[model samples]
Target: MPHQQTIERKTARTTTKFTGEVTCKGGSSRGIVKDLSAAGICFQLYFDINATTGQEVSIKSDEFGHLTGVVQWYRGDKIGIRLNVSSNTSAQISSYYKYFR
Candidate 1:
């Protein structure tokens, strides 16, 4: 097999273990926000659900309001999502970290 390299296309903010929840058309899953950025976010669900790539989702928590995004990737119970909103999402998350951390 040829060696493969994965390139990161987005500038990810510093990782933070923030708790949150994700909801889809089928149901909802609780998870921890592992990494966050202006373009996307990465989180790990406490329990695996029937989630797949290209699926639309909504994430919400006490620190931030409902965020709309689409699932970009998933492995086991961890998932990466690309937000549909503007870059303001990143600023809000960054501010939350600075004040709450």
Candidate 2:
């Protein structure tokens, strides 16, 4: 199948260590964000065997702020999250855009 539309403005994801949470069918889990973009994010978890693929999740970061997302993929202690919004996100995103540039 063909890929969907792009949402992120940056190709290179900036490294970020921020607290976040994931809500799945099993429940919520506290994790750390590895990096982030307007479209998606990567998590570095303490446990490797909690979440599953295709699970709907919501994540909130101190730096990136709150976002409703879904688990696109997962492997080991790392999971990929696709953000829900296409445009008009929080001020934190704009802050990231300015600081990173």
Question: Deviation in angstroms for 61 in model 1?
Answer: 1.6
Which residues of candidate 2, in runs, are more than 4 Å off?
A: 1-10, 88-91, 96-101
Clashing pairs in 1: none
TM-score of each candidate structure, all chains considered together: 0.82, 0.70
- Provide backbone clash counts, one per model: 0, 0
Please, what are the lDDT tens digits per residue for candidate 1 over residues 1-101?
A: 99999997757565878899998876789999887877788989987767789999999977766788999998998999888867667677667767876
Please tell me which predicted candidate would have the highest TM-score against the true structure: 1
lDDT for each candidate structure? 0.82, 0.73
Question: What's the C-alpha lDDT at position 81 in model 1?
Answer: 88
